[model samples]
Structure formats: structure tokens, C-alpha cells
Target: MKSKIALLLFFALTAFTLLQNRKITGVVTDEYQKPLAGVMVSVPNTMISTTTDSLGRYTIQVPAYALKLTFVLPHLTTQQIDIGKSNTINVTLKTGRINLTEALADHQTVHRKVSGSYVKMESAPQTFMAPMQRYQPGETENYNPINENGFQVASQMPVTTFSVDVDRAAYSNTRRFLNNGQMPPVDAVRIEEMINYFDYDYAGPSGEHPIAVSTEMTDSPWNPGLKLLHIGLQAKTVPTKNLPASNLVFLIDVSGSMSDQNKLPLLKQAFKLLVDQLRPQDKISIVVYAGAAGEILKPTSGSEKMTIKEALDGLEAGGSTAGGAGIELAYKLAKDNFIKNGNNRVILATDGDFNVGISSEGALQRLIEEKRKEGIFLSIMGFGMGNYKDSHIETLADKGNGNYAYIDNIQEARKEFVQEFGGTLFTIAKDVKIQIEFNPRHVQAYRLIGYENRALKNEEFHDDKKDAGEMGSGHTVTALYEIVPTGAKSPYLSKNDALKYQKTDASDIGKTDEMLTLKIRYKKPDEDQSVLFDMPVKNISRPMAACSENLRFASAVAEFGLLLRGSEFKGKASYRDVIARAKTAFGKDEEGYRSEFVQLVKTAETLDNRKETAQKD
Candidate 1:
């Protein structure tokens, strides 16, 4: 009975924490009456903090449960102010020669009166952020190991099941490496994402279902003996005005590490593009994390564009990252303001650095997994380079049931937030999984191109409770399978011994004109149960040169990825051949994304050649 009482109390306290938040707007200046651009304005002992913007102004969200006191810790001196009922606290610094660390140590001196400084006390949160971490070479970047899928004998393993992946982080990240004239690490190349990053001309759904599937067969580009299977999915498009009302919480990282021009500064420009597309029916809130997570802006109607923009403009980077705590607070806010049957999501813009409380990938994964069940989705947008954590961000995107896009530059940022707004923020279907069953009579062996991390157990395919990928409006997904025909000779094929007690041959399963059967499962955005569907793929193959542009373009991407990773199964693929194939398939170069890809490949080939020349010398 006592334990039950404690549990109830815990729930009550948590409820109180998510209840409300107040905004404090202020400006800081030196004794000379000139505005200070980088002074740290923070609520000591709490996760809430911000630095002065270029204009020497700032706004911070103080949770209703926080203690009323606020302090300004600047480079020159430390000054503490008590919370007295006012929402605005403008500060002016003390003109002194005291060392910053030394002054912070003197409680009496630190609390000395400073003109124009105001404070308010009301609530407090869980933990305080420590000092900033040092960033160095090989500082904080990590990509998880990928054991690429190998060829499977069709008779032994006839079916391949895996969830659909729509993320495009790897493509942009790889571009960053190539632009820097360096080769991306092997594990950094995810061929599935690299392929899906480009837009395909597959027709959209014209049926009752929200997603449509298309398939094609062509001769393998690298190996003449093998066949390439092209599978594509296109989600039905919904007009912007017809889309669901959104309850968006922008969870931004204002940690000191984001002080670089490309980090927090670039994020400001990127989010501007998203904010401009908001409708009056939609709502937005802003939550920032550093030493602690704090709400800088409460839920405001989208009609108030200037108000939203002001809040964004006022945010500045400082303090250590409390990413885990920030995520919890963002989700809490999302739940509190959730729009039933609407788009409720938390968009986290980060460098993926989680240094403070609850920072491990496993812990974050569990947190996101729980939040996803509660109906609020998560979208992670990563920025900056040094200390970027891809493995951690990838886990959150997978478990949180959301898509990811890396904003490497301002242009890529515009492409995502402006050009692909609907697909980035709105979800049409969730838990989308695909299963492909090969006919042993037509195919001897097969290998999936990528998606090493998204493979699912066959039994999990029909399990409604199992989590999968989400598809947004107008989003497209593509996957490739390399097949070794029955009579074709291939070095990649693996043979298995006949079963001792049971039938090993699948020839008795009966032969049909179909090459394989394709099955797709998905749930409506607001649904718990999934709808299953399948289609038969005819056993017909097109010559590589005669295949459609979609097939040819995708093959080029796969070849490039294999070359980048130096995959054992790359066969006789060459960078020059990949480039030539891509040039022929630049269908309708409207956005120029495909053209940019061709140029990127050329740059990579040059880099590869340079390395070879250096090795020979």
C-alpha cells in the first residue's frame, strides 16, 4: 500500500512538471552601457540557460516548477538575482577585474547588486549541466558496424523480410566528406538511404491504400550473369492545405558545443524555412536544451509568425548538452498539446551530443520507444560535424518511428525544410514492412543491396505489435535485389548442404511464370492494426541498356555505394561506368538533385585516384 502511494505521488509530480512554462525576455550590457553579445544568462541549478544574441537580447522558458532565482554568469563577473514576480529580467554587468572562475566561487561577491537585473523564483527541474566537453580529432563521431547482407541460396532462404527505410542522412553526410576532399568511412555509407535519397518517377497510389508498389527486372549492371530487381513504393500525395493540423514542438540544442557558425547559426536559417509554411490551424512550441532543458516558447498559434520568429531569433548557444532531458521535456509538451488525429511531433535539431543525464543510446532508444507508443512521433535533424553522433541519432530515428535528414549546409537545409516540408513533417502511414519471396526455379541465389539494420524476423512481419518504418506524404522508397539466375554462373552464390531429415529442394513448390511475390504491410497514421497486401512479379528481365531510367539510376547509386565501401560483392563495377550510367538516367532534371549526385561521384572518383597515385609513389 505504501509503495502504491509513492507511485501515485510520482505520477502527480510528473504531471505538474509538464503543466506550464513562463517566458523571461531580457537584455544585457556592460557598465559602459554597451550591449554584451555573448554573456551567459542562466537559471543556476536548473537545465534552463541561453546566451545573449548579437543584439544582446535573450528569451528563456522557465518551467512553472522551477525555483524563482536567475543568474547571469559572464566572462567579466558573476551576478545573481532573486525571483520576485516579474516575467522579464533585463541585466547589466558589473565592471570588475575579478577572474570569472574566481568570482563565481565568492558567494557574497557573486550575489552583488547589478543595475537592471531582475529575477523570479517559481520551479526547479532534475539536474544541472556540467562544464563543456573538449572537441578534438576523432572526438565524438561514430557509425555502427554494418555486416552487409550476403547471397542466399533461393531453395534454403526463399523469403526476405525487412522494414522500409526512408531516411536520407547518409547521402548528405557522404557529400560533406567528398566536398571536404576526404573519403567517408566505409560504415558511413548506407546504400539504401543513398538510393532512396533520389526521387523516382514511380506512380503514386491511386487505390484505397495510401501506398502503392511497383517492380521491374533488369540485367545486373556490374555482372552480366546476374539480374537486378527493382522495387519501389510511392506514398499518395496530399495538398498542403488539406493536410492535418500540426502540433509541432521544435526541440533545439543550444549547448555550447553548437557555438560554431555551422551548428546553431545554420539551424536558425533552416527552421525559418519550416516556420514560413505554417498555417493558422497549426501550432508550435520551442524547447531548448543545454545545461538543462527549458521551454523558450509556449504553444503559439501559427498565425503569429513574428512572435515565433522572435523566439527563434532570441535563442543563443551556451552550456553543456542535456539531450536526454530535453527529449523527455519535448515529448511531455507534445503530449500536453497533442491534436487528436493531427500531426503531433517533436522535431529535434541537434549535433547528436548527449553529455548529461540519461545520455546512452540504449537509454534514449527505450525513451523514444515508449514515447512512440503514446502517439507522439520524433523527427531528428542533425547539423555540424565535429563530435557528430550518427549511431546515436540513427537509433532514435528507428525507435522513435520517424525519418532523418542531415542538414550539412544551408542549401540542404532549404531542400529539407522548404522543398520537402510535407514529407518531413507529416506521416500518412506507419509500421510499413516488406517481404519478398523468391521462386527457386527461376532464381538460384539473391542478395539485398542494403538496409543491414532494418531486417526483421519473418514471424514479426505479421505481428501487429512490432514496430516498423513510417511513410510520409509524397515520400518514396526504393530497394534492389541482385539475383543469380538458375543457369547463370556467379562467384557470389553460396550453396548449402541438403537437409538430412527433410526435403531440401524447393522445386516441388511448383513453378510459375512469376519471379517472386512482393508483400507490403502498413498501418494508417492513426491506426493500431495493419493492412497487408501482396503482388506477384512476373519472371521477365530487361537488358541493362534497355531498362527504364529509374532502374538505371538506382543501379548507378548501388554501384557507387559498393565502390565506396569496397564491398567484396562489388564484382567488376568501376567508378567510370557508374558515372556514365548515371549521366544517361538524369530524367527531368528539375531540382538538379540527380545532376548533383553525378558531380559528387566524379569528385569521389578523383579522390580515389589521388589516393592510388600517392600509394604508388
Candidate 2:
């Protein structure tokens, strides 16, 4: 009787202890009622911490002594609540920004001022969210909240951010060639400009608000010499609550040319990783083409991971590429399983070798053009190395009203899929174009670096029907301008007194607000008509030595791109300068991107020096 009583007492104590340690479960969100994924929820004084999942839901066990729990996200105001008998706690994180003006004013003693041949200036009151806020591992924040009707509603405005750098020297060289009535060097082509020419990121109305642009400017080279201007813009992302079910068709190429380890195999791994993020409501279909096209699997829910894995594993490289047929069948399947108001997309993975039917470029272009009208979006993922058809893939993407990405490895795949889920998958705005008019008084000669193919005739700026690129959610696009001061003597343009169109005595022309005007055109996600926005340029000239941080970083990136392309305009640029400029502009070292850039410069230097030595030999 004594032993039984002791066992019963032990059981009672255990049950009480278990009850005391019970977990709290709830969802975390932002002010917009969107799920806030990857938010860290933890007991403030303890080592216990858990992150919210894709649904922004988290379950964390806490000790009885724990008084409260805190939820935190980088660049967001942290939230904390007292722990109670209730087993659930929902949290909402408020977005925060870092103001450059505040930092500068708070630490005026640390700021160094210097003057050189050209004046330099720091960034103005710049406001930006931390990189972690933009891209955090495992972060999944909903863009919209579910409505009372049980259907997900869309936000009114969709926004995105984009950043790219163009080599100034290369741009100038291309312009010089154009002025001299000659074809520019093939390497002078700016891919970023081409990519940005069309908006690929913007998705339409979630029914919340119109998109707004917050722009910041900084000096270039991040050094005393202001050689560039860094421009950054942020747009609010479109919100999607309980988004309609999606039907995705993966059109893969298992051709002989794609037998490289980084080709077919890499494609498989990338797709597998994406599959992990798929929701139960999402359906995936796999189609493979070599000598001919064939459906490997019908549409299946994401829950059937094993079945999808099996299909991907069985794929083998054998015959010639039949890209046309493959695309046709994939579109057919997508049309059959069309989800009303949901994302219907065909993701084509290939090395872009189309050797079989409809191999003619025009024919392939027409095929995609016709299908684009059906509301199914296309995205081209290029893989492999040698003989990769960048041109062909680029054309197909352009015609199909889609985007193209070059996946070098698994990391890039993650950057595209996991890190930028919204931008990669959803379209908020389309046919976005930018046109800048420069005043002859403020700038003698200005060159737009990069974006050779994206350049439109001045009249095309107002043409709404003309197709442009789409901007995705949370993506940033940046452009730079290098202007020669009005009084500056032209280095390449010679004095031609005999020219009939020559005009003299125009030296009094000065800078004016009309010196430059920036015009942007974009269409709402579901609408065909476009809206225009314009900003006039002002005579805000600072010494080149006092360029802002944004300017410095952008200049460095552009210089690096020029060096990589080996353009003739890379006159005085050195890799060392690029590294120095980037390091200077790297304020917080948040994601180590600046550091990585320095390393890439070292690599470029080694490669360039080797080439120089080989040429001498």
C-alpha cells in the first residue's frame, strides 16, 4: 500500500509539471495583417527562441517562471507581451527605417570633411530598411490578409525594388561609337538595362493602397572624389491574401548538351528545393523534352513530394532538344488546368538549345507571343555553360511577357526562389519604362551606362502599348548617369568649325531645372492601360569628392561591370579603386555583400593581370 501511494504521488507531480511547461501557439503578422514569417519569438532572459513558419504561426514551450515573450525582426520594432494563463499569443511587428540624417547629426564629430578639385557630399536624409528585413532566411511574410468571405483579398498597390550597375566608361565608349556612325562593341551591351527595359516584378491589386516610391540619392565611389551618383527607390509590394490556387508546369530540357553536372543535375536540385516551398493548394506538372516532348507527370499537389521526386530522379539526358514541342505541350497542360484568378505559370528550365522543330527564331517567338495572350506567364531559367543560347532565351522571355534568370548554382536558385519569393512569382506592375531628359546647360555630354537594348527613341517614352519590363515585389532597380559639366571640354568630340550645323557663342548656357526630367510609365497588374510619373531634375551639383554612400557603391558596381566586360571605355579605372570605393560606402556591412564585392575585385585583378601577361608573351 505504501509503494502504490508513492507511485501515484509521482504521477500527479509529473502531470502538474507537464502542465506548467505547456507551449503557447499563435501567429505573428505585420501591421497589414500579413503573416510575418521567420520572426524570432523567445523568452527575453532565456536561451529559448523559435521562428515563425510560412503561415506566421509559431509554437514555443516556456518555463513556468517565464513572465513574458518577445518577438523580434531585423529593422522592425520589437514587440513583447506578458505571459498569462492563455496558451496563445499573436504578434505584429512594425517596420522601421534608419535615417541617414539622424545618424549624421548624432555623430557630427566622427564625420570627416575634405575638399578636392571636385566637391563631394554625403547622402541626404536617406531611409532604408536593413537587408535582413528584406531577405531573412526562412522568412515568409504574407502580403495580404484573408477576408471575411473566406477568399484571400488583394492589396491595392504592388511595389518592388531593383538595383543594377553599368560601367560608365563602357557606356561612354558606346555613345562615342554611335556618334561616330559605327556599331558599338558587342561587349558594350548592358544586360541590366535590357533586363530592366521590361517590368517583371509588379503584380496587380490586392485592394489596399496605391504604390508609392521612396527614393534616396548618394554620392558615387564612396570616397572623396564624387564620380558617380547612387539612386535607390523602394515601392510598396502588392498584397495577396489567400492567393488563388496555382498551377505550375515545369518544362525541362534533358538534352545531350545538358548532360553537364551543372546543367540537368543542377536543374533537378533547384526544382527540388522549390518544391519544398510549395503549398498543399499548389499543383505542379513536369514535362520533359529531348528528341520530342512528353508529359512526365500530370498536375499533382505539393503534398506528394515523393511522387515529384521520383519523376525528377528518373529524368535522363539522351536526344536532341525539341524546345518548341515541349513548350507547346506545357502550355496545353497549363490551359487545361487554368486556375481562375490564380497564378498560372510555365517555368522552362534549359540550356536554350532548340535543335528540333520550329528551330527558327522567328517561329519560336511567334509561338510564345500567341500563348502570352492566354494569361499564362512564362519564366526562363537558363542552366549549363558552354554553347548556352542567351539570345534565344532572352527573346523567348521577352515575347512571352516573362522574365529570364541565369542560375549559376544552388545559391542563386535560393536567392531567386526562397529569398525573393514574391518578386519571382508575382507580378505587381508591368510595362515599366524610364526616360531621362538631360539639360544641355547642366551637362555637356551625358551617357546612360548599360541598357543598350532597353534604350527607346525619345518618342517611345509616351507610347503605352509598347511592352516594357515588369517589376516584382521587393526588388530594387537603380540607374546611374555620368555628366560632363557644361563648360567641360569634350575629350572625344573635336572642334569642327567647318560643319554647317555648328553654332558658336553658346557658352552662357547654365544649369536649369529642365536640365533633366525622369519619366516612368507602368501598368496596373491586371490592366492594359498605363500610368505615367515624372520628376524634374534640379541643379544640385556637389563636388565629385563629396559624393554620397549610394553614389560610391553604385559607381564601384558599374566600374566592376565595365572591367568584367572589357569595354574600351575603361580608361582610368583600376580594380583597387573599385575595392576602395566599395569599402568606403559599406556603412553597416549587414549582409557582407560589400566584402564579397572586394573579393570579386581581387579575382578580376588576377584574371586581368594574367590576360595582360599572356598578351605580352
lDDT of each: 0.81, 0.59
Cα misplacement distance, residue 287 of candidate 1 (Å): 0.3
lDDT of 1 by residue, 1-617 (tens): 99999999999989987767778788876555656544555665544666565456777777676555444432234567664678877777753322333433322112111231211223322112122222344755888899999998887788999999999999998877776567888998999999999888988898899999988898887887898999999998889999999999999998877766557766886787688789999999999998999999999999998999899877778788899999999999999999998999999999888899788878888899898988899999988787888888888988888998898765577568766789988998999999989988898899999999999999999999999999998999999999999768887765568667754465665758888999999999888999999999999987878888989999999999999999999989999999999999999755456777877888789899999999999
> What is the number of backbone collisions in each predicted candidate, taken in the order shown?
14, 58
Candidate with maximal lDDT: 1
Stretches of candidate 1 above 4 Å error? 1-137, 501-509
- TM-score of each model, in listed order: 0.78, 0.64
Per-residue lDDT tens digits for candidate 2, residues 142-173, read 11111111100001001111222111122322
**With candidate 2 superimposed using the best TM-score fit, by how many Å does residue 291's alpha carbon deviate from the native?**
0.8
Best by TM-score: 1
lDDT of 1: 0.81
Model 2 regions more than 4 Å off: 1-229, 238-245, 494-511, 543-548, 587-592
Q: Tell me how far the alpha carbon of residue 268 in candidate 2 is from the true structure, in angstroms, after superposition.
A: 0.9
RMSD of 2: 17.7
